[model samples]
Target chain A: MPCQILPPYLLEKIAACERPEMAHAATAARRSLVHDAPLRRLGDRSLATDQPSPVPRIADPAMPVESGPAPTVDRTVSDAEGSENLPGKIVRTEGGPVTADSAVTEAYDGLGDTWRLYWEAYGRNSVDGRGLPLDATVHYGQDYDNAFWNGRRMVFGDGDGQLFNRFTISPSVVGHELTHGVTQYTANLVYQGQSGALNESVSDVFGALVEQFARGQRANEASWLIGEGLFTAQVHGVALRSMKAPGTAYDDPVLGKDPQPADMAGFVTTDSDAGGVHLNSGIPNHAFYLAASTLGGYAWEAAGQIWYDTLTGGLAATSDFAAFAQATARAAEARFGGSSAEHAAVLGAWKTVGVLPG
Target chain B: MKVYVSRVGGVAGIRLTWQVRVDDQPDADSWWRLLEDLPWQSAPSGPVQPDRFCYEIKAEPHEAVIAENELDGPWRELVDRVQRADTDSR
Candidate 1:
């Protein structure tokens, strides 16, 4: 869901000051885009593996930029030694080559910061516990409004330039994509049905934590909104997605209401896109949001701990929502006593989202 | 080495692609077998193209550099400490 609500063509019409006609066209376009069959069931796919042909690697030493001053970038998630550049350093408008003040730079900085955060805060070097050369592709498609960790590299679209700004600019978005890599290494959560949804939720949790840690904001002091600053003035949505509020993220008439279901019972049962993994993610997304808020501090410090443990531990890969909830509870208990605030936060967060751990 | 995994139906019906680089020479058969053993569902078919021997996993997204020794105990301890400290109250 990294793309903007309004498609570029329509936004262009509106930006061109075609008040009545362009607005009407944009509205119609939005409706069609929303109902666009492929988009509705995004990320829905049966987990089937294909043998990849090995493409020969020709190591070109020529592209080598001097490895600046021995580990110039701490490359650790929490190193705090790297530049304290703000997350919004990269910004892009109109889908032109990435501007220094555009979303791409922000994404690059965010990715590097997140990597450093994990390293400094936890001693973890990179997403895979290895120094993975972080690669990201910004401005993927023309007005192509989505950011994805396409399994190899992070690909971001410029957003239609009207409603959505640049996907790479938001630290949360960068975190979201990078967390996908973490999931891949850990549970490799089945990207279908409830399991798929949990995978998405994990990304959301970690993504928010990256933001909270960078800003030095505690849970209460934080907004708990996923893509708060992503939308422009024309966007009628609150953010790209709301972990705390779930379905309440947006309710604009033209863009259609947010379709995330916050409770287990309300879990969406669909087969369109990998069993609606992204759609059903709302339930777990809400759970993590509540857990972090209840824990009441830097999310990456407490709530992030439990979730990360669950992911890397035996609960990986095949774990579903119920299983994930149980695992999180166990992790909390193992990390903190069963009655500790962190443990309580874990339990309360799941319950708030209608998931009662057994 | 660039490994390409093609799932008949990828995540959300979109083809899922994972590319990884290994320091050693590329081995197709080994990579395919490894991918087959991955936790997620993998396409069951003949080798798509270049056949070599290597470990493979159905890739989803993101990037990483594995130095073989990276997953040793020291790395595990480092990750575990981070996980525990990041979540436990200061």
Candidate 2:
């Protein structure tokens, strides 16, 4: 699946609006849907052929592997220049001077930050854990309302000024999309039904953690919001999805209420959105927030580590919420001892979210 | 006659539906001609790609659901026209 930061349900609400003032939003939503459809099809064909690995392996000859000591952070940011074409003009390369375009600079920096969090916190090199050079394309399409990682690289949209700002405006959004690459390389989670929801939840967890790590904030101090500043002042919302409080992220007249359900009780059962990957993700998202906050201190230290281990530790592609919950509990037990608070917290979190028995 | 074109499948899994009355459109005859000859019952059978789209096109009496890539010739033209017309109207 093409990992889009903005959920489709939100766009559907915007598209369905009858208000005269919402015409711009409606048009943008429809355009975004039309634009993203083929990209998803492209992603499917790519994944079917290529089996990615953590260890460095020659996949594409065009992207030559760097010799000598492994490069820590090799990033390339491109400018789409308001067209749909990806990896457009190479505006900035690794260790190069900052670009005048804030989106370009932000994409460059956000890639580094995500890399730092993964490498520093979990000892993973990059998205593929083998120092895979991060590449991003910003300013994609005219008034495009979404951002996504299309298997190989990150693509950001210049949002319709009516609702969203530049997608790269939020570092966690960058982290979130990049983490989709991480999920792709590791779990290879089937982006459908429960497994897909788990895939989205895992990205949200790391997205929030990457921000927390960058700001040097403990779990208690972190905002726990994904795409926090992506919304414009005109929109009545703090962020796209709230880890701390899922369904309460946004409730605007034009955008409608946030449809996320924070527990299994409210789990959305539908064939849409790959079985509500973004919607039902709130259940596992809330569980992660609970685990991290309950464990206290730097979330990356224990909570993040546990989740990281669960992700990279041979997680099945088709694993569901219960399976993921059990894996995290196991990871916590393994990392911090069976009797440790981290293990108890992990188990308690799943129980609280109704993913596990109380 | 009214034509309802809905696109489903994508990472978000949300469906987009656009309804257009044939008489209201400038290309009404073109739409009617295209729909008349379309293989309404012959949908491509296979697993849907992770985030790819499949379209369900209903033009009153006839309906067809075709895969994103499977769309061809007049069917593609009709879908494109309806989507463009909807966006233009908005």
Identify the candidate with maximal lDDT. Answer: 2
RMSD of each: 22.8, 15.4
lDDT of 1 by residue, A246-354 (tens): 7777666445677778888778786444566666788988888788777674566667767776787667677778789998988776655455688888888888777
Candidate 1's docking class is: incorrect
lDDT of 2 by residue, A112-224 (tens): 88987786566577898777899999998877666778888998888778677888899888888888898988888888789988888888888888888777677889999
After superposition, candidate 1 runs with Cα above 4 Å error = A1-101, B1-90
DockQ of 2: 0.21
Which 10 consecutive residues of model 2 chain A have the lowest summed lDDT?
A55-64
Candidates in order have lDDT scores of 0.57, 0.77
Candidate 1 interface RMSD value: 11.0
Compute the interface RMSD for each candidate structure: 11.0, 4.2
Model 1 residue B22 lDDT? Answer: 29
Q: What TM-score do all the candidates reach, one by one?
A: 0.59, 0.76
| DockQ, every prediction | 0.03, 0.21
